[model samples]
Target: MLKLAVAPVPYHWPRARILSFYADLAKAPCEILYLGETVCAKRRALTPQDWLDLAETLRAAGKEVLLSSLSLIEAASEVSTQRRLCAGSEFLIEANDLGAVTRLRGREFVAGPGINLYNPRFLTRLHALGMRRWIVPIELSRQGLETMQAHCPVDVETEVIGWGRLPLAHSARCFTARVQGLAKDECALSCADHPDGLVLYTQNEQPFLCLNGVQVQSALSHCLIDAVETLQQLGIHSLRLIPQSEGFDAVLRTFDQVRRGATTASSAVEALGRLAPTGLCNGYFHGISGMDWVAPPQVPQGQASLDAPAPRKQ
Candidate 1:
């Protein structure tokens, strides 16, 4: 059976709100929950002990938890922190960088989407290094996934980003701070102000990108709620749903219903559109532009679809 896993919150939410969000999520239908900050380490809404305690709570609530490492390792202190996380045997660590990958060798670990798992050979190497599961990079198409899975030499869990804004890139310079005219070192934690990230628009006022501290993301949320059967056919073991500021509970319920056969994919797609007010996209799944929404054949007439994209550049 396919399973759902919650990715750690990428935004800098307030401490109280983070607690409330997890408290509500503890009872959600997800089988796995990833805890810890995956972006800028400056946004310390929770300490190491705090994350461990939360992991224990989620585990007690019947959820498997993994601590996620930062995507960018710019400092020795950060490397030490990841090493400490790798040393722990209580919870599995999700390695987002090569440093964590090296430290996590010989122990079961998750390869985050940030890692370049572009080929079967690379995946085989990681598998030899103790990678038990890996999240498909957001930019990889369905066909790409199929090819990689076909050539994969060993068995490993394949997880895809089922929902949330696509984390596109990370930089040493904090884009959010620069936007606020603050230096990266003295940014006053401005990311906490925009929980969903600050949206950037094009000249025509079209949503273009999102700036979240050092990370850049797609303005529209990535969704694959209607592709459950396709995922199963591809032997995907899990759907990793990234945390959002609102309507996530509905997102969970909708995916749960669809996966459990209580509702149709078409119905789930409709519900998902309403949840993501900025609109939903799955074009990356169809080998098209990541920002465009290419509706699946399962969708019926009159359903809300974000299609009619400009012709792809030849």
Candidate 2:
């Protein structure tokens, strides 16, 4: 059976709210939970120890926790932080960057979505170094995954981003701060203002993208709640669900019900729409553009309902 994992908090939530959120996750159906900061270095809503503290609570709740590393390494301090995360993390490390993998070379780790695993040879090299599970990058099509898994080690687990806005790109410069006319250095913590991430719109008022500190994301929510069978057939073992600000618990429940056969895929898709209401996109899975919602034939049959997007309040 495939595992249902929750990625770390991508939004810049307040410390208190973050604490409360994980406390609630104790009751959620999440089997695997990836913790720690993976986005901006400035969003220090929780300290290393604070995250570990929550890890203990989550583990008690029967969730396997993993510490995630930053995707973009900007400075020596960040390198030091990654090394420290690998060395001291109570749980296995999720290597978003190669440097994290280097630090965790002799130990087990999950390859995060930031790493490109398109080449089976490259994946083989990582598997030799202790990559137990690999998260297929958001852009790679299902065909790419099929090819990689054919040659990779049998023990290597495959996980995919099942939902949430796809994190597209990351840079040293903070676009969220830049748009607000603030330098990355002296900019206020503006990310805290837009908890779900600051929405970026096109000139014609179409949803274009979103800004989450240094990370750029898709405007439409990426979903695969309807593609459970495809994932199972592809030999994938985990569905990584990124945390959203609202309707997160519902998202977890819906995915769980769908995966466990308790509810139909159509019913799960409806629940996801109500919980999030953001337009759905599954193009990347079909080897097309990342912004289109092209569901496979085996998935539930229905027009995706995204009438009310999650409010973008400051």
Best of the candidates, lDDT: 1
Count clashing pairs, candidate 1: 0
- Structure candidate 1, residue pairs in collision: none
Model 1 C-alpha lDDT per residue in residues 1-314, reported as the tens digit of each score: 78999999999998899999999999888899999999988888899999999999989998989999999989888888888888974898888998898887778889998899889889988899888899999888999999988876556889999998899999999999999999999999999989989988889877778899999988788889878988988888999998888889999989998898999987777678777747778889989899888776766666446662232111
Error of 2 at 213 (Å): 0.5
Worst 10 residues of 1 by lDDT: 305-314
- Each prediction's Cα RMSD? 3.5, 2.7
Worst 10 residues of 2 by lDDT: 305-314
> Mind giving the per-residue lDDT tens digits that candidate 2 earns over 17-58?
898888888888878988988998778989888888888888
Clashing pairs in 2: none
Candidate 2, position 191, lDDT: 87
